[model samples]
Target: MSANTDSQLAKRTDMKLFSGEKLLVIVSLIGFALAAGIAVYISIYGAIILPEGNAESAFSFNAAMGMFILSIAAILPVSGLSPGKRASVRWFFIVAALYSYAVETIQHLRGINPRFSQVGTVVDQIAGGLFGVIALLIVIATALFAIPFFRKRQPGERPLLVLGIRYAFVSTMIAHAAGIWMIVLQSRYTGEAGNLIVLHGLGFHALQALPVLGWLLERSRTDEKRTRQLIHTGGIAWTLAIILIGLQTALARSVFELAMLPFLAGALLLVWLVTVVIAAVGLLKIRKGSMVQTNTVSGEENRDLV
Candidate 1:
């Protein structure tokens, strides 16, 4: 009985795209698309259609957030899973996402922006703290699952996809923390909450962007080793960029408004650039060595044949 069960499990493991995977993927894609569309629509038509002080606009924004959060929760279980592999962490993401949505909903309904709320001045502070802690936990979980790939890749895991997920999670974590801190500590600091909230949104949405990039790269038929390297570099660079943005906002500055911390943001970008150059050079050297080895093997085979 044990042997039969083991054999069946092995067969399932070998199969790709198990039942519901395709559907889940589709749902994820739709959710991402809707989120993007809503964002754009709000940006362009927001002032006119759902102008500030409009209760309807607040409701609309909260509704969109609910949809976005639900979509994210749906994908969380499937994001790291490969065929037949038991989910390592599922309920954590779901609970976190749901709790975050609930808190945000309350704040939105109250017409108080979570990021702009003063310390102890409003109920939004409570919501921000709760949601911020959850986001931080998700970030930690993502790092534990992702950052170790510096040495080797996991079984049934596409290193690139995992890296993307990790990048997005970390970005969201930093954004959340920064927002909560502003509310709790820097309420007197009078830079617009829009800057901080924008950073948070960018980081949170990386979950969609990176995974989509991975899918496109695969479809492009790029070399596997190169693809992995590209994804790794991109993920790292992207995460660093977001972190830099978070730092700037934490300092009460807008994105790219680095006059407040003149050299810091540029220095972060420079560091990322240097890291990318180093990675590219290393990849070139490895590829060169591989070519030399292959040519040497071919010559040896030819001499033996002669």
Candidate 2:
């Protein structure tokens, strides 16, 4: 087939597949239900069945649950877009979740971080090693694929949707990078991480946090321009907050430390200033574009009248 004919044929196939949109919705819904169900089961089991001292096992379990949630959340909306794009992003998430499930299940059942354990046999150690590598790859893939959502697009696209997607990406990328770094450092030398675990958990949650906040903002009957500004401002502030927490953790300082309180207050002020600057710049650019379009429309109307 000629190139044009091939393109037309491909487009026809996509249209036929996504025409009803019902199947995609059903698939996403089923995935969501499965994730939520597993999450609930795990939570109850962790609280009731598991012994209290197994910190590593608990972390693994929670990470598995979180990955499942993140995968479904990230895939559902993206599925509504172009099918090829949806397939690429969706598989990345789904595969990540599946891999996490395997690794966490192993950790809980066997009780070993294969990299550190001399007790485990070769197979177990190998699986543990594979877990870390797979996790790193998944985080990298998620962060990279999420970039397209941040790019400027037509006006009708909801600002909240864009901000939520980008925020999820940024937060996950940072959390995973920090976590992988911590793993490396631990392998090299056992170090006390004052609040590294707490920091990482909070940072990772921005995936759900900022996105839900954006969704709440969307429900307000605010002006679209104002909403966009709010999103940019809120997202930047959220990023800064996560960074500060990570930094404080790296310094071996707890957020609740008496000395850190003053710095935390100062950071809040800085966040406010930075958010204002970013929001102002976004508003100005939006205003300029609106004026230019308005002028063009007015000119065309005048010509018609004449």
Candidate 3:
């Protein structure tokens, strides 16, 4: 029985899409399209579709969030079998995406805004803290499961992919926290020069690239030299940008505040654009039949050793 089970599992592990990763890429494209469409649709025609002051007023938020959830429904399928694989992280992404929608729903129900409320203030400061702990636990679980696969990764490879993504996620969470702080004590933190605050620009977006870096590092996707170069350059750029923005955010003069808003927002948006482009490049490389060039573990190496 054990032998038969192992054989079956081996077949699944060996499986790859006929189109390689294009299958997943197509799914991602569709998801993004649907999410954008849903968001725009609701934003533009919502008042016409759902009358104001009716119970339907909040429906747009829920509906838009639902659409976002649908776009990533492939999360479970993406994770495949095992807790440690990219698929597992992919699944967590699905959870995060869905939870984002759920949070939005809760926000709408709270009944107070032309914009989103901070989770820390309205929900519980403890809620984000608790959720982070939970996410860390899940990451640990997935890492343990993936250890076998990860062990095969190259020793010298930089995890730019994973680093990028993790940073992005963390930055966003911190963004929410900062926003909450700003809202709760708008007077003190809003215009105050003395208060310490991270710049709200490229820093958050730059952070997104960390997870991508980590995943790349974990997978041993490319040359050590090239990876190191990427990390050094990208990290420096990200750091410098973050510091500049943080400084601006923390110490911009009162009159210049509104003027700086667009630049700040644009900087963050640019970071996201750069991150997305990197992911696209990664996908392109995979499609172009690039290999990770790791000597530590190859199909033959792992097959014989493991």
Candidate 4:
């Protein structure tokens, strides 16, 4: 087949996958709406109606935001899958998103913590237990969706993006492990100084951070070898940072405490940040160069027409 024909076929397949992503897109929008509503409500009432000492607004808001972020992150991975696998994962996302939204919104409105509430009734506890199950389902779905990225690069797949996604999935799994730890302990705190939530939150964001870096690098027109090296540098740094943070948390020490472990983690994070900045600069330069070249071509064409 002609290269043009192959390209056209790939485009059609991509379009079909994109169509399947609509449900997830809608779910993400709902999450955003819910988060906005909760924020507005909190601003208006200032916790007057919320249960005392529980930070209901914050919990509800964070839940909504998490749904939104995860849905958005899932889109690319879902699109990378075969049609049958894509459909299954897509449905799993819908179920998990809706379940989370309902449980978080309802429980918070009823003056209970959905994940951990000593004062909640039996039903509430059941719902919280179900929430944990849903979380495990999400982790499984994510792992399935991530499989395609690890397979041999298909025709037209961007190398850097795939590498970034692999790293992101690994880091996200670590984040999920941290979440499971919280579920087992029934607390977000590890000890006097440690807060597992910090590790959880930071680890989850590797999904957005590393993949985005790879996407940007793909467009940056940097050398292929250099781009791959940078992605590896960033991914390794990010993973090491998460590992250090996890170890610190497990040791009952604060992630930000003045200690060697925390300091090493901070330095690794800084290294990742530096790589991101470098990629951003490369992207900007390439875009600027492209714009100038386009303008030049336009001017030459105009002269030819005249």
How does each model score on lDDT?
0.53, 0.58, 0.43, 0.77
Q: Which 10-residue window of candidate 4 scores lowest in summed lDDT?
A: 48-57
TM-scores for all candidates: the values are 0.52, 0.64, 0.41, 0.88
lDDT of 2 by residue, 32-75 (tens): 45445545655665422332123344454445355435444543
Q: TM-score: which candidate is best?
A: 4
Which one wins on lDDT? 4
What is the total number of backbone clashes in candidate 4?
0
Better of 2 and 3 by TM-score: 2
After best superposition, candidate 2 residue 258: deviation in angstroms? 2.9
Residues 166-205 of candidate 3 have per-residue lDDT tens digits of 3444344444444445445542244655332344323333
Every candidate's CA RMSD: 9.6, 10.0, 11.6, 2.8
* Cα shift from native, residue 217, model 3 (Å): 11
Query: 30-57, model 1: which lDDT tens digit per residue?
Result: 4445445545655765523311122333
Better of 3 and 4 by TM-score: 4
- Clash pairs, candidate 4, are none
